[model samples]
Target: MAHDHGHDHASSTRTRLAIAFAIIAVVLVVEVFGAWLSGSLALLADAGHMASDAIGLLVALVASVWATRPATDRHTFGFRRLEVLAALFNGVLLTVVAVVVAIEAVRRLTEADPHAPDGIPMLVVAGIGLLANVAAYLVLRGGDRRSMNMRGATLEVLGDLFGSIAAVVAGVVLLTTGFAAADAIASLVIAALIVPRAALLLRDVVRVLTESAPRETDVTLIREHLLETPEVVAVHDVHVWAITSGAPVFSAHVECEEAVFAEGRAGSMLERLGECLRGHFDVEHSTFQLEPAGHSEREEPAHR
Candidate 1:
């Protein structure tokens, strides 16, 4: 039953991602043509961002679809982690695009008699691109925003939307004042906007890849909660981490009174401990290895 629910969620996310990708892909084609016709750096930069966003959305869709596969003996967790990898890739790609755009903008700004871009065409294309991005954003807004895959796709669309706005503003300035550097300036602004968000996304992806605990989880508090269990005497080797965006996993070694094993109460104690974790920490998947007091000395535990 739980498995079916998860599958449905992934399917819904994939559908939303597909819709967004199609919109971005169409807008990308139009923007590329407009950039070529107008020779506007702002339009070109926005197009490049849109291209990256289209790729990001495609990756997210593939990852969401992959996540629906059942786990196999050889791959116990199945393909859920693929979504994290896709998010990391998307962040890195966006960062690279931003850097390239910034460098090109600088070069254009320094050039002598930089050609005046066709502001009218830029305005028309940017307006169209903005509308398209807004549509994509609306499509994804209702989906799972907590998932890194969905978040990555959303981030891309948001960046593209901002890029479109910058392009339109630059177009207006270019048309009114004939200031050729306005296009370059807008490109730089778009690049600047992308860098911080990309960096934050990359940081989150790295944290997950490293198996660090989720930011919202506190290991000490969880250990304390386990110790509060009547049958539990001590808790050690507690570890908690996110498998993906919304899926957190927990494992720990819990020492209980020796009577728990002798009286056949270990099973009940384990269930109670699981309940405690679920109720207090919102952890749905947990593994607790119940051990008798002083058992750690016999086998040499990994951590105290």
Candidate 2:
């Protein structure tokens, strides 16, 4: 039943990504034309962001599909980790787009005969792009937010959302007040919105790649929980890490009572420990090696 629900959820997420990808593609076309017609750097930046988003969505779509491939002898964990790689790419790509836009905005601001954005076209096109971005954002927002791939995609749309707003504001300001710097400033605003979020996502991607435990997981608490079992005298080499977003893997070496080892009761004790891990920590996959007391003396100290 759990496996079926997970499959259904992935299917639904993929469908949502498809819908968002379509919206972004259409928005990119409209925004590109709009940017050209109005000479607004803000609109151009938004268009560039949308282009990156289109590619990101494609990567995410492929990752999501690849993640479902059955495990093979060569790759025991299957391709599920590809989703994290997709998210990593998205984060880096978004950061590059923002930096590029910021540099261009600064150059435009310094130009002696900088083109003043045409407010009528900027307003009309930005309005259209804004609506399209809203639709895309809403579509992606419905996906599994816990998944890094989905979070990256959703963040891209959110950047687009804020970019659209900046452009809209720039348009209104330029149209009503003839503020020549509004377009460049709006472009900078769009860049600003993307960098921080991209940095945060990159941090998460790195955490998973490095096999660090999930940020919210407490190794100490996990140790305490294991020690709660009377037969389990001590636990060491406790390691926990997330494969992607919600999928965490755990392993530990447990020091057990001499009787538990000698009396052939380790099997039942192992079940109890596994249940504790799953029930209390939400860890579905775990491996434990039972050892007699003081057995770890022969082993080197673990990284923990």
Candidate 3:
């Protein structure tokens, strides 16, 4: 079985994430200062979100770099799963930030006669934040979104984009109507936007960590395809899972005709089975054990 080593893909993605992190880092500083100067909770909430984005980008960048390291005997997968772990951490961080923002927003909303937030500075700073997020989004947009690591970073940028938009709206409302609650309302909206995506990312990470089959692969269909091959009597003990995004591995035991084994055609049958898995199922890594019928009953099978 051939392994598709995505070295170039990982390298390019790392570069993009690094650049995006730099852009977001600058924006985070600006927003924090702006939040302080304007006393706008919306801007503060956006700043907090941006801080999480910066951390998420850093984790993604590290994972990308770690994923490229050569495999060792102790760690055969060679840090590939680091990406998934990073994504999990990012999701948790985002949820925590959202919770904190929501708590503060609720407090502001209920407090009587809150002072009007400074709108002019909030508007100016939030506009700059929006522009920065737009640039970050564009930079990270070109990578494979199927990768959990990239998706985590992309989600951060996406959330920041929405946060900036909400801050701008809050600034506008507070400026025109002297409504201080608008800032708190915008913070609440930003928190709401963060929950769904963070939950999705967390769910995906958990699936991978639990060694669940990828959502796209169907085990029943794979079993049928193997049974269709010539001289194959039965198929059993099939297993499929992903090593990482876009890389699936499979293994199964195939019972074959006695003649096929006696004639020394087992190797040919094995090759054909591998080809079938690769061509039909996009499974590039597979191992098939060819055995005569009843052989499984004779020997203790690892999986019945």
lDDT by residue for model 1 (82-149), tens: 99999998998999999999999999999998988999999999999999999999999889978999
1-304 per-residue lDDT for model 3 (tens digits)? 1234466677789999999999999999999999999999999999999999999999999998988788899998788888998999999999999999999999988888787789999999999999999999999999878788998899889988998999999999988998889999999999998998899999888888887788999999999989999999888888888777767889898999999989999989999999999899899889998989877776665464
Model 2 residue 77 distance off true place after TM-score fit, in angstroms: 0.7
lDDT tens digits, residue span 53-149, model 2:
9999999999999998889999899999999999999999999999999999999999998889999999999998899889989999989988999
Better of 2 and 3 by lDDT: 2
Residue 125 displacement in candidate 3 (angstroms): 1.0
Give lDDT per model, in order: 0.91, 0.92, 0.90
Clashes by residue pair, model 3: none
Better of 2 and 3 by TM-score: 2
Task: RMSD for all candidates, in order, please.
Answer: 1.2, 1.2, 2.1
Which segments of candidate 1 are over 4 A away from where they belong? 298-302
Once superposed on the true structure, which residue ranges of model 2 sit more than 4 Å away at CA?
A: 301-304
